[model samples]
Every structure is written in structure tokens, then in C-alpha cells.
Target: MMTLSAPLLALLWLVQVVCSAFPEEPGPLSSIPTEVRKYPVFLGRPHRSSLRQEPLHIQRILQVNRTLYIGADDLFRVELDNVVGDEMFYSKKRTWESNKNDISICRMKGKHEGDTLEMVGETVSGMARCPYDPKHANVALFAGNLFTATVTDFLAIDAVIYRSLGDSPALRTIKHDSKWFRYQLNKMVVDTNAGPHGNRTVLFLGSSRGTILKFLVVPNQDNTAPNNNVFLEELEGYNPECGQDTPQARQLLSLTLDSNSHTLLLAFPSCVVRIPVARCQLYSRCMNCISSRDPYCGWTRGSTCSFLRAGTLPFEQDVDHGNTSYLGDCDLLQESYIEEPDGLVSVNLLVLSAVSAFSTGAALSGLMVCWIMTVKHRQRSRGGGSGPGGRRKCEKEQNMLG
Candidate 1:
């Protein structure tokens, strides 16, 4: 075997130590897929009207290309790109409990200078009393029609879906005699494009318990029902958690859908939970349906996927944190979908390289100091040795002096 110098051996040992200390490369942070194109769309801020002190409880958000419409507490606000101010419209009855409360619908028209949002139509469906203590009215538009539901006497009161006919004041009801419309209290309702055969679907969420129910409206030959109206059937139902009468269950706030991914994001007191629409469609279940491929179904960093615990702020807090607006109603506006650049991998590589460089420098510096000390110790021992060669040299010097 070839002999190696002390410094060389020490350097080899140092490298081995470093290799053992750190083996795997740090992974990159995962991100959702981005849309292809983007336009500068705007959404108005909710709770802009002073009469309502509380921020407008955003019930439903709809994007029709670049124009965005937000339905909140019996008010529909409209905003358009290049437009300076938001146009507000209030339905006849403002509170959620009144018998004559109407669901409001707004659609954009014309160009910026002379643009307007026509109320078009309203519905005063008398179903049940508000279930929540301070119950708020909820409204949503689907398949070119409007659907409103409120909690009354601890039961879900859904208005018969209505379709608007041009600028006329006439409102038609969607006639469907299916058992799906039966009494089960629904606190919030959201519209989705994931109906059977790609038709529009409505997702209803329960108030007292976090029960998610889906209803599909399919077109039928029954002209007795309107052309826009179809047979309403219960597609699926699942409870996110078991213990209903607890604080977590009582905190059941609202539900929203990400149309792009078909993901259902549910909000409570402290945390937000995500459920996959694809998984729900396939399994007809919600429990254990959360998977990596699912959106918002996973937990936030260093947090559990269960009920959002107390002491943690809601995701909406990110909106006005530091007085910075996160996403206003107008900002919810969507144009052509824009693809976000894939920079996560590059960022991870950069971070790993920096850390590796720093660790290598620290190890090399330590090895260099140890090597110098070893060499000096060896030299000192040799000088102090009483070996045969050193003794003969000392004897010769003494004899010459004598």
C-alpha cells in the first residue's frame, strides 16, 4: 500500500466526516399548477359600505372572464378593469331572516365609460326561518340562474332556483320534484362546474355540523320545468369531522371552491381544510380522501390537518395583515388564466449550494488547524528524544570540548 502524508490523511478523514453528517439534498417546496394566461382583473373590497360594520361576509365569488361578481349579505358588488369605482346593488330585503328576502344577481354590460350592472331579477322564496343566531343570507349563480339558501329554525331553506329572461322583470322557478331538495339545514351554498356530464353543479354546506352535500341539476324533457331547470339529485354527502356540538363544529363558517382544480376549501375558526372534488366524485366520500394530489387538502407547514386550533389566525388575516390588502373583492377578478413561473426548483438548488459551501469551508478550516498542531508536536518529540543517534552526537561534542 502507498503511504500518505499526515495532512493528506487528515483531509480524507474530514471529507468522510462531512459526508456522514449530511447525506440528502434539501427538497424544493411544492406549488400548485399555474394557469396559462392572465389579465389585470379587479374585485371590489367587501364591507365597503359603511352601513355594515362587519366586513361583507363573502358568500359567493364568480368570475366571468375578466368581470368579477361578489355576493355578500344581500348585496352584489361589481367591478371592471380600467374602472375607477365599484358599483353596488342591494336586494329589496337586506337581512337573511325576512320572509320576502330576495336573492340578488348582477351582470356586466357595455364598455368602461358607460358600463353598468343590471339587477335583472330577484327571488322571495319562503322556506324556513334563519337557523343561525345572527344568520346571514347566502346567494349564488349557476348555469345562468340564481340560487339562494338561508338557515331557518335550524333547517336549510333553499329558494327555488330562478332564471332571468333578458331585461324583463319576470322571474321563473326551476321546477324539479326530486327528494334531494328535502329539508336538511344548509348554512352556505357555492356554485361549481362539476355537474354530471359537465353541467353546472351546486355544493351545499351544513351549518351546525360540517356536513358537505352536493346536488346536481340535469336537463330533462319535462317542459313542465323550465329549460334552465332540471332534476335535482343528491350526488354525495360527508361529514368532515365527528364531534359536532363542540367549539370546532360551532365555528363552521363558510365554504368556497377553486374552479380550476375542482378543490373544495373549507374555512373554520382557526384553520382552513381542503377536500378534493375528484376524490369526492370517485369515492363518494370525504373522510380519508385528502391526498397529495388534492388541493388545500394538506396541512399548512408545521400544522396539523385537523380542526384549526385556537390562537391561530384565519387565512383571511393575511388579507389585511400590516394594513396590506391581500385580496380585495375587485382583486378576485379573473381574466385569462395566467401561468405562474416555475422557480421553486431553482430556488431550492440555490439554497442548497449556499449551505454546502458554508459547511465545506468550516470543515476545511478545522482540519487545517489540527494538521499544523500535529506537525509541531511531532517535531518537539523528536528534539527531546534520547535515541542512539542523539546520544553519540552529544558525546562527540563533549570530547571535543575536553
Candidate 2:
């Protein structure tokens, strides 16, 4: 039996990419085919492209550990200290140069809120040399230390968040062969759900090469030590081929997952794009849908993929509880859908405007009739031609004139 070598395997992967269908921005929902319209619109938001500019689009901004999201709301009753999280990011300038002084220099730092990144924090400077690279900083609210999740069996002391937590520290390391090269770690995103693993957390790490790493963030149940286990794993890979020959090739600078939409939005130097979780419906057959194990997808009647609901699936509640196996009963989803511009919303608005115009016209006509009658009454009073006597007077006057 003959097996393909690494180079041959890579070449085959590239070939598959060349043959794969390129992702196109989906058309307006109204224009979607009738056969496909009934299907749910998942990850494709109203955005056609990202909001970024050239020169402002720096690839270095998307480095791993360079950007990290720390959510305080996720922790239940964990204690927090100011000293542990005082400096959010490492000094980019200090890291590249040979400075013997054990101080991290950060010229720029900003706090992100909503759609704005405000430069509000004090300029972080003259900090003690952190044991680990700030890019690998992974710590929980329970403990303010930082830890880098790696596949290597042996632990790097400088990268450990907490050296000791009794028997087991609140840290995880996976012992496996390293498939992820290009250690220029680019981004980290924390994911939390409300189902069975509600207590458990997931981390999405973007590597410099072009891969997003998924890890189950293990926190210590008790105040003592954690379960001494590897927390990170290579769960899924969305490596779209960077075809050198193809005109459209993307080198990912950053990765952000919309927890609500279950969409993975990737930022490149010049532009941004998103991966729709709803495309799981492309699995038109029951066998393929179930085997794929996508949380957002379910097999429907006639063996077509159907979206169970909007947004990212709650792993334990939706997948573990068998929501992914839903077949038929699709009518229940009729009410829970996005309205198209040329569809329901426009029709409703049109009807409302027509009704308003009709009402205004009727009101004006009635008022004009009333005003004309009032004017005629006043004129007749002045002319004395309203009552029987006034009628006789008008006849006498007509006779006189004759």
C-alpha cells in the first residue's frame, strides 16, 4: 500500500482548495430561490464587507495574545485583585529589542466597548518582566495569573498561570505532536454557554500561520487545585486554502466569533469576511447532517438540513439533548425568522401608508362640504331667501323686475 508524504499531502490539500467553491456573499433573502428560501438565514448579516481602510489595516494588530477578551460577568463568585490584571497587554516595542531591565513597555493600550476603542487607560510602562509572553496570557477571574495553553507535554514555567494550586493547579496542557507551527500567536477569544458546560469555558485562539485553536478552559472547582488536565485541543479547522495562484487569498490577521450568531468573522489586512454556521444546511442528506455533528444543523423531513434556531447552539442543551436530530415539525420555526426587505415588513408598511392616505382624503372632503354649507347659509341670511317669507319676497322682487 502506498501512502502520500507530507509534501504530497499538502499539494493534495491545495488542489482540493482550488476545486472548492469560493464563498460568495449570499443574495438578498427575497431573491433566494423558493426551494432555498424556506431555509433559515444564519451567519450572513446585512454587511456586504468589513469597515476598514488601507494603511490602517496592519497585520501585526491581529497577533495572538496581542488581543484578548476578559469577561468579568462569566465568573460566579471568584475573587479578583487589581495587582494581577493591572497591565492588560505586553509592550510590543520591548519584546523585539534586547532590554536587560525587567520592565514591560506599552506605548499604546485602549479599552474596547461596543463599536468604540477608547484610549482611556494610563500609559502602561516600567513593569516587571512577566514570566510569560503577554500573548499567551490565559487566566481566570478566580485566579489572576496567566497561562499559555500548548500541546507540548512538558510545561513552560514562564507560561504557567499559577505554579501551585495545592495538588493540581488551575492550568491545562495537552501532550501531543505539534501540528500548529508559525508560533506568532495572533488572537484569543473566550466563549461561554448556558447549558451543561455552562461552568466550563471555551477559548478560540488564532495562530499567526492561519488556524483558529479551540480549547476547553478548565477552572478549579474548589479554591485549592484544578484537575491537572490538558484544557486545549485542536477541535475544528477553518483553513481556507491561501491559494498563491488564486487572486483572492487571505492571510488571517485576527479572528472573532459571534457567540450569538455562531459565525466566525476573520479580519485580514485589507478586508474582513465571515463564516456562516447555517451553511451546515448544505448537508442535504440525513446521514451527512448527523455525522457532521454541527450544533446549528438538524436533519428535517425528506433528509434536508434544517437550522434548529438562530445563533450558536448551546452545546449540551442543543447537541447533547438531541436537538441536532430534529426531523420534520419544521412548521414550528415559521414564526421565528428574519423578515426580508421585499417581504413581510415592506408589505405591512405599504398597507399602513395606504390606509392613512385614504383616511386623510375622506376627512378633508367632509370638512370642505361643511365649510361650503356654512358660507351658503350666511349668504342666504343676508339675502333673506331661506324661509317661506324669504321665498315670497324673492318671488315679489322677481315680479317687480319683470
Candidate 3:
């Protein structure tokens, strides 16, 4: 018999913990054969998310040219790129030589006349921006910056390939059921891909609790409308701690995706880790793939279910490319088939949880009963023996004297 690797053992342990307490059975999602399932590939082998020597003390993190920069009180670069140029989204046209800044900007000429002009993505440096204090009693800035403040007068907003900062809705973390969404909103990432919708955009919100939520952002029916209609009905969520009933607010300082290696870097409160996005391949069976409500994922004709836009490197698309489901004229997914709301995994977890609760409750009840019996026996032994109840002042005094 061969001994298991430390990492594999650790992963198995984590699975037991997370899977056993799953909120509900993953329904059919978890019912597929293990062979057909795209089990996660452990890129860093026994890849743990929070194992850093120093405490994760940053507020935000950004990936530029394969370098991960963190922001909290200050911005600092982490220079641990095993494969250089793996995490950045854009190509560097020129070498940067600057003072006081390590992350350099590679300028691209504007293609359209109406496009917002600036050094990088439209915002110019050193322009006097009206800094209005939101906490101020009554002062604000809205109309002067724009040609007009009227809702009808449309203002063209400059955006990029990333949906996180593009024309999307306000980030809402609450669930539809009114249960408080447990994760603390830390950072957001937009995954651009071709979808059935048109230009597909799925937003990934990282929380302080180490959970990453997959959200769908659909614009209003009117083309010119601009207000976040965030549909918190998520397809899947990843919590690094796995199966923790109430996960602590362990902030993910930043998230970086390595396109070349198909890896993802997550900076947590305790440590930083690299996980393979290739392993996150959600669908395998074509039917299941089509059934998954994940917007950035799709089932190819070849029976391969992966990211909808995986093959397109240096992926070029108008900022609004949609999901593959649009192309799938497949049947609508049944309520039991969806993975987001509930899964068969949750049922297993619930059963284990119920048993655990009952066991604990019974143990506590037995202890309470024993304590009560002991107190009753002691009272009978005392039998009005002036134990401060005061049968009579003289009798109480006699018992106290005895």
C-alpha cells in the first residue's frame, strides 16, 4: 500500500469537513459520477489559502504585469511571480521608468473620438477633481462635472474589458431569502467571456470571510439605464476554510488570475496562495453544463464543460460579450437541477448536523437533570433545618447554633 502525500491527505481532510456539513445536498450537481466530475486539480498541491507567516493586513490588492500590489494604508508590490507576465491582462508596449511608482502604465491611443481621454483608462492625472465630502452637512458635486445633471442627458462613461469596474450595478451582498449574507465585501473582479446572452460578464466578489461569490449582472431593459440591478442569485461560492458553519471575517486582500498557467492568486488575511483556475472547471457532462446557472461557464459540443471563453487568449471582445447559454437552445433546467440555491451535499451535511445537535443537546440535558436531582436531595437532607428559609426565628437560630 502506498502512503498518501501530505497535501492530498490535507485536501481529503478538508473535503470531509466541508462536505459533511454542506448546508444541503448539492441535489443532482453532486450526484454525478466522480469520474465525470471535474474534481479540482490541486495546483500548489494541498493548496491551502491562508498559511502566511505574517498577518494579512491589506485592504485591497491589484495585479499588474504579473506583480501583485496590495493596498491598505499604503500600496506595496509582492514580487513572487514564478512565471513572469502570467497574471497581467494587457500587453506592455514600453518599458516603464518612473519615480515613486513601480506599476507602470502602457498607453494605448484612443480608437474613437468620443472615448474619454486620459493617461490610462480615461481619468487624467493632475486634473482638479471636485472632492465633495459625503459626510458634509449639505455640500455636494453632481451637475458641474457633467454637461447637465438631468437623468435624460446621457453621459458616456469610460470603461475597460474588466466588468468589475465597467457598466455594472451596485454591489449588493444580501441574499433574496433575507438571511444576512455572511461574507464581508472586500473586492470585486469581472470575468469577461462570450456567452449566450451577448457579451457575458460575471462578477466575482471576494469577502473577508474568504468566500468568493459568483454574481450575474444584467442591465435594465432600457439600453441607457444606469443603476445596479445586482441579482444576488449566485451559481456557486468558494469559501477557503470549507464547511465552517460561521466563517470568520478573513479578508481576501486581492485576487489575481494567471492566464498562461490558468492559475489564480488569492491574498488572504493570514497568507497568500495560488490556485489553478483550470481546476475550477465546473461542468463536464454537456447536460449538466447547460444546467449550471454559472454565467461565465458553458458546455461545448465536445462534451467538455469549461469556462465559456477559455480558448480565447488575449481575449478580445467588446466590453459586453455575453454567456454561452444564449447559444444553447436546450431545455430549461429543473428546480432540483440547479446548484446555487440547494444541493444534495447540503442534505448530507444537514443530517450529520442534526445528529450532532441532538447528541449535544441530550448530553447537556442529562447534566442538567443530574444537577437538579443533586440539589433536591440536599434540600431533603436539610428538611427545614434553618437553611435561611426561616421556619421560626428560634428554630433557625438553634439549627445555626448546632
Candidate 4:
């Protein structure tokens, strides 16, 4: 019999003792109420222009009541209604596109009966391009009274932010003095409900280094410029390490703000990160966990936790198992659930490790016993065979007697 070393036996016994002490988690009961989790909203594939070979650049996001406004590369603006359905319906009545050279603005109206949006009104600006380049323009609505757009340009290349006065004929401009190479005006969050008299702030993603830059745009009483000049002020900036090259960074493909809390939700390839506006400076981030009040964190197939530099929350339970398909990158907007029928439920790592070790010990012991038995049987068979000399002697004695 194979004998286990003292240390190995003790170790195996300890594991078994611990496993016995810790009871297996009970299965889900029908009587218990499970909390449903919500996921980040993901829009469909970004719209790109045929004129340019570059993929569509989703430059800015504007959330107005129940509608979402999207600004993209090649001067395209799209509006999506906020409703639960297979395909998000776009408003066909209001859409705009600017010319390639940044000369004129084209306003188009769309009609949507069910799911299809058809173009209706198409108005082109008299000027082929705006006096400033549209490439650098960022758009925002301020105080429900004025729309402002700002631009920061390099050399002859201009960056502009455009704000249109709802039905008014006038347009406002907020110009940037600093030299900029490449930049993306990503998102705008208006904290009207928080600040005095509903102040507005805009968030943008700077190119090359992927810096998150924020700007405050408001009505300026001291207007010296002709374009109903609006004041543009820099609020704050953060480098999410999101860049065009790094896979982890690139996964931060999109961002949006919670309408109620104004918390920023950054969508990545694997998981979504949430940065509360109050704690933006500290870079305090929270990720979705298998069990968290935060709508973005939850359990799915192949679910795993990646510790942020700040580590995880104390109460947060690390995910132990599940497929990540429900947590796909480009599809964060869809809601998910941790149903009881979704295969083996998650378990504690410590428990699993201990069980595996004990099973391995048992298997090794059985193998040693089998080997010893086989050797003993072979020895008995050899002893039963007669020697050649003994057999010859017996035959000679029998011949003499005869």
C-alpha cells in the first residue's frame, strides 16, 4: 500500500476539515425575491460618411428629455428616442449635416412612422462653409435660451463649437485660444437642476492622449464679438488612458452621463467604469460586480473582476463564474439578468481549490494500491512453475523402477 507522507496527509486532512466546516451555499429558492440589474445603454453602430474613408467618429452626445442627440464625423447629427425596443427609433423630422469643407450647414427633416426615418426638409446655408471650420466645432444648449458652439484650430485648421437658438435666426460661438492638433467633443452634461439657475457644462475627449476635458459654456453679457459671443471656460480634465492604440484604452469606446445623478459611465470592451461627478478629481471608479446596487455591475456568464487601482468596494463580491457574452463591448445598452437556469452558479474560489486538492490525493492513493497488487500476483505465478532439474530427476527415477 502506498503510504502518504505525514505532511501530505495532514494537509489533506486540514482541507477536508475546512470544507466540512463551511457549508455549501444554498440554491436559489422561489420564495426569495432577486434584484434585477441594469446595464449601460449602448447605441447601434455609429454612422459614417462615404466621402471620407475614416470610420465614423462619434464626437458628441446630447441628452434632451427622452431623446438622445448624436454628433459624428463628416458633420452628421442623429436623434434617437429613449424607449425599450429591438431597434431604437430615430426622429426623421430633425437632422443636420454640414459640408465637407466646413462652408455651409445643411438642415434636414426626417419622418418616422414606425421604425423607418425618411428625409423631409433639406435646407443648405447660403455660405458654402461656416466662416470657421466645422471640424473643431462643439455643440451645446445653455439655459434653455441659447445654443453655443466653440472651435479651437491649429495653423489654418479651425476647431469650432456651434450653439443654435432654437427658433431664433442667431447663432453663438465660443472660440478656443490654445493650439490643438486633434480633439473629439465627446459628451455634454447640463447640471441645470443642481447649480443655481441651471448652469451647463460640457465634457470632451481630447485626441492623441485621450484626455477627458470639460468646458463650461454660458451666456456672456459682455459680448464684443458679432456671433452673440458665449463664454467658454475650462473646468477639468482627466486622462482615462484611453487611446487609439492600447486595447484596454480603446475599449473605452463610448461614454454617457446618468440624467438623474450626472455620473459619467465609460463603456469599455470588458466592463463599464462609473465616475461620479462629485468624485471626478479623485479618479474614484466603481465597476459592476455580481452583487452591487450599481446598475452597471452584475453577474453573467464568464464574469470576472479586474481590480481598479483604487481596488474594489468593501461590500462588493468578486465574480466567480459566468460567460461574458452578456457583457459584450458594443452592446452595453441592453439589460441583463442572473437567472437561476444559467448553468452552474458562481462559487467561492477557496472552496473550489480545497475540493480539487482532496480529489487529487484520493486518486493518487488508489493508483499506488493497484500497482502493489499487480506485483504480488506476478511473484506467486513464478513460484508455482517447476525447475528443469527437478523434472528430469523425477523422469529418470520412474524409468529405473519400471
Candidate 5:
């Protein structure tokens, strides 16, 4: 038997009450198998230059091949190299450094012929930039394009690797409107390997309301011009304990995707949650699954809607065009209620048929009435006779008794 002191038991009871007030959320669904690596390796931090006085906070990290790019107030490039049997090695290089004051000199260094010198100069510093904000925006480097989104704007820069900042023009810029868009976008993740052909760039945007907006951006397609940026669907990632019209906003702190697990990691202020990108279990039947139009889901064996696993064969999925007729037996959807007795089914079918017939008859009667009224209106307009009773009271003197 275990015994606790009075103060210890009081502490335990308080812990239990606090835990009950904030219970853990349900774990996300995961069907894919993942390999686990328990060994750990730590890399040495990069040495900072003496010129950098402030402490650094890494805002974003991106890896391309063996090179890792770290963005902070400044930018760094880390080269990770490991030869055949040697210990892993890496080198860090500071690619760009921010200045407290940016001094711009135009024609400052020019050749002087016969003692005349001209210079034009401008300098600015410490202007607030959204990209420099710690966690209020996101920057994505995908397929030679640089996409950046802040709370109030979105911009796409094309072929950023080839063009210098002085010459690279913005490909697209859209200012956010809260009145119409209804949410403040602060976090975004770009998935390049998406869609049926696996060549689309799909963006998952996270808003202050704990909602995610999924959309596709087709840049310079070969055949036709690209379409407008229309969101495919709005998924509720987290529901805040607040009204829709509340003035206070709950911003998403972090949003990232795990490609191996096919899940999204969403971090809010109060809690963290994992959401599977595709919820195939919501669809029960073949037609229903096919109509969902989710690329990550497919109708597989056992007549079940399931996540599309690698190397799985004979699955039915059509994300581009959700054609229910692809199964050739979608008529089963109409007769899915097979558990009912034959008499009950027949009676239900008769009632359904009667209701459908009555609806059609009522629609036709409405159209006929509208047509007759239109004709009477035209006749009255042409005759043009009016008194207390419009249309001349059908000629009162025509009654013989009168």
C-alpha cells in the first residue's frame, strides 16, 4: 500500500482537477506504416559573427538536397555532407544579414573627370516587415516559385533562384480583404506532389478561425490560361470556444504536413492536434467514396473507402472528375436499403412514386396558370378598358335582367 502526505494528496487532487478541465483531445487516424529510428544525432550550432548583437530566433527552415536554409532576422545556408564511412559533417554559411540601418548609395562611386562629382543617396532603416515577424507569416519555396503570405497579403515570385532581387518582378499579389474573405490568413503549407497526375501545387492555408482553406495554383499551364484561385473546400481544423462574430481571433501558431504519415500538424494557442489530410472512412459506399473527389482517398478492397496506400492495386479513384458512373453499378446506391421487408419496400416505393408524380403535376399546373395569366394580361392591355372594376365589368348592360 502507498501512503501520501496531506500536502502531497492535496497537490494530486489539484492536478486531477486541472487535468479534467483540459482533457487531451482524441488522437488522429493513421493507417500508413512508418519506420522508426531511435538513434539521435545533434548538430553544432553555427557560430555567430561579432556584428550580430541580438539573439537569433529561427523563423523558418527549408531543406533542399544536402543544403538546409535557415531564416531568422538573417538567412543562413548549411551544407550537410557525409562521405562513405566518415562521421557526418556540416558547414554553415551566413548568406544574408540584416542591418539596423540600410544605407543605399546611388552613383556614390563614380569616375570624376576634371573635378566635378555628383551623387544621389537614400537611406532607410527599421521599417516593419511582415516577413520579419516571428510567427505571423509563412514563406514557401516550391518549384522555382517563392510564395509568401502574411495576415493581409499574398505574393508569388517566379523563378526566384535565377533572378536577382533587383530584377525579379512579382508574379502575383493579392491583398486580403477580411470583410469578404472572413478570416485572417497567417499560416500556409504548400504540397507540390498533389492531384491525380502528381504535378499540381496545392496550398493549405490556415486562418485565425482555426479553419483551413485548400486550393490549387496552376502556374503557366501549357495549353490554356490558369483559372482563378478558388478554394476546393474549407475544413474545420479546430473550433474555438467563441462566437463567429467575436472580435477576438484565435491564430494558428504552426501548420506543417508529414508526408510519410499523410497528416497535417496544426498548433493552436491552447492545444496541438494532428489531422489526417484525407478522411476516407466518412464515405461508406463506392459511389459515395468516388464522389468525395479526394486524391488521397480511394475505394479499395472489402468494399471500404480507404486512404490510397502506395503500390495498392485495383482501387477506384478519380479525383479530377468525380464520375459516379465509373463503377458501372451505382444503381446500387438507389437500392441500398435492402433490409426492409418486401411489402414495406413496395409501399415506400409507391409512396415515393406518388409524391414524385404529384410534384411534377403541381409544377405543370403552375406553368399552365402562369401562361393563362400572361395571356389575360396581354388581352387586357390591348383592350384598354378601366373603371371601378377593371376590364369594363364584362359589359353590365349585356345582362338581360339588368
Candidate 6:
């Protein structure tokens, strides 16, 4: 019997719709591997008797063509196919000496080594300096540059991108807000094929808070311009309601991408999860798919969402604008979602609720009036002694007595 205010009813409706759209306890989408192979790539010891034994911590390892480039206490390279099986992989590796004592090799001097990777006379003099300190698992090579996303000091976190220019390497560094210590960035993966042109460098950064942030780095055609890196979005890796014991358990340690499958792998302290690079399946309807504004997804002719690859004809997508005008007379548009702030509702819902309340009140009022009138009519009929029949009976009784 309670009549809720229009605004309150509208807010309740909005909450219900949003909750239905995105469930709190989401169902599982994929499975994790129960078993994986473990292999040791490198060993750290006093290389044939030295004065000191420097700790060997590999910061990053990347494979290009057939060669595997490693960033560790010293820059190392080996054949990718050779680093497998038993003790046969160990060979006489050529090491380069640097004048700097604590040199964590984060970049390679390709020109100095040239066609012949001569061991003698080559040094770590012309290589780029290591951008990250305590450099362990904080570097990525993407689009011909070395990128590091790590905490520089106690209060500063930075994402530095650098590359070698000519025969002599010069530093071309772009730091993404060193002063921004909101979230400690753990690891990063760069994707150059994010857009149609394949020039838009998209960085997927894993943070310490179990979150992956996507950034779109604008190409610096003019080197003098300031860095134009745009923050795209942040994806949640852990649900807070799952009740983790410690914050360390939620930290993401590794981020890797498989281009052939278009899958992004995330490694945490507790488990490893694989997610699609573009989640097109979430958009079940045509309107949702078209409005997602994701370059990697589209609504296909099969009436399902799928990856927008080459020869994917008759697919609907608008990455730049998400314009729905292209979808002429879409029946699914009615099911489109509307996002509103909490404790607030749209004007259309408010008006509808007000009209509904008014109609309900009017119906109740009419029912009350009809009930009262019916009761009064019954009382009047009873008092009149069933109309003329009661008067006739009284008269006949008096006549009989006389």
C-alpha cells in the first residue's frame, strides 16, 4: 500500500537493470592449465673465478626471429632453438665488460656487433642505460624500442620508452608520469596492431593492484612534441569480494600476449589466467557490439560477435565514433543500455513512474468511494424494514386484534 516517490522508483529500476546486465558473481569463461613444464634458462655463478659473484636476475627476455635477447646482469643473446634439453645448451658465450660497476644491461648494441658477433674489442659503452632499478621483470621490447614500467624510487613510478637511433646510440626517453605513484606498475606488453593502420602503439600494463591498464601512445611524428599517451581503460583482474588474504596475492607479475590466438595471458601470485585481447562475446546484441568502440571486434554476418580480421566482410563496427546510424532499422536497438549515476534516474523513467503512481492513486480512490456508497445503501434498506412489506404486516396484525 506504500507509494514510492517517482525518483526513488526510477533509481530502483536503474539499479535493477544494471545489476541484471552485469552480475556480481560472474560465471567462469575459461579454464586454467593444471600442469605446465618448468625449465631453467640461465645459472649464476662466479664465471670461471672472479673477484665477486654478481647476482644474475633476468629482467626481461624477448625473442626476435631466431635469436633470444636477454636482459640480465649483462646483455646476453642465444639461439632460441638451442636453449632446450639437458646440459647441451651450455657453450662458450662471449661476454662484454662495462666500466660501470652495477650495469644491468637493459638494451642491446646491435650496430657495434654487426654481422660478425666478434667477442674481442666489443664493449657495453654505447648501449642504453637501464631505465629500471632493482631491474627484475620490468622491461619489454616493442616496436624497435626498450620499455620499462617500474617504480624508480619509493614514491615514484615511471614507464620509460627508449630506443637506439643511429650507429652510436642516443637516449630517446619518454617517461609516463614519474610522479604518479597511485598504482605500482609491475609489467607491460605493447601491441602495435591495435588500430587499422597498425601505427597506434597500445600498451597493456599490469599493476600491483590486480588491474590491467590500456594506453594508446600517439605516434610522435615530430620528435619535439610532448608525449601524447592517452589512457584508454582499466580492467579488473581480481574481485575484491573473493576475500583474498593479502594484497600481495592480487599483484600481477607477468603480462604476455599471443598474436596468433589474440590472447593476453596474465600471471598472478596465486594463478595464471588467459583473457581474449578483445572481448567481443560480452556484447551479445548488435547495438552493444557496434557501440563497444573496439577495433578488434565486430558483429559478424553469422549473428554473433567475432574478431575483425582480414576478409571479415559484412561485419558492423565503428571503432572511432561508434555511430549507430550505420545500423539502419535495428530491432536490437530497443534493448540498448543507458548508464546513469547512482541515486539518479533519467527524465523518461521519472515521468513514467509519476504517471503510474497517479493512475494507481486514482484507482484506489475510486474503489474507496464505491465501497462507501454500497455500505450506505445497505443500511438505508435495512432501516426501512424491507420497504412496504413490513408496513403491511403491522396493519394486518392490528385489524385481527380488533
| Per-residue lDDT of model 2, residues 117-145, tens digit only | 56886773211213233433444332344
lDDT of 4 by residue, 194-301 (tens): 222233333333223223443333345667743321222222222222223453334334566665545554443322333433321111122333322212232233
TM-score per prediction, in order, is 0.25, 0.30, 0.34, 0.25, 0.39, 0.38
RMSD each, Å? 25.3, 22.6, 28.0, 23.8, 29.9, 19.7
Off by over 4 Å in 6: 1-182, 195-201, 216-232, 239-245, 333-402
Candidate achieving the largest TM-score:
5
Where does candidate 3 stray beyond 4 Å?
1-60, 69-186, 192-198, 223-249, 255-265, 274-280, 293-295, 310-402
Across 328-372, the per-residue lDDT of candidate 1 in tens digits comes to 332223111122265544333566799999999999999999999
Roughly what TM-score does model 4 have, to 2 decimal places? 0.25
Q: Model 4 lDDT vs. the true structure?
A: 0.40
Separately for all candidates shown, the number of backbone clashes (residues 3 or more apart, or on different chains) is: 15, 6, 30, 34, 0, 0
Model 6 — which ten-residue stretch has the worst lDDT? 31-40
lDDT tens readout by residue for model 3, 123-209: 532112222222112222343232111111111111111112224532322223313445456567665542434365656666655
Question: Is candidate 1 or 2 superior in lDDT?
Answer: 2
What overall lDDT goes with each candidate model? Answer: 0.40, 0.41, 0.44, 0.40, 0.53, 0.56
What TM-score would candidate 2 get against the native?
Answer: 0.30
Residue 340 in candidate 3, Cα distance off native in Å? 26
Decoy 5 TM-score against native = 0.39
Q: Candidate 3 at 102: error in angstroms? A: 26
> What count of clashes does model 5 give?
0
Model 5 lDDT-worst window of ten? 34-43
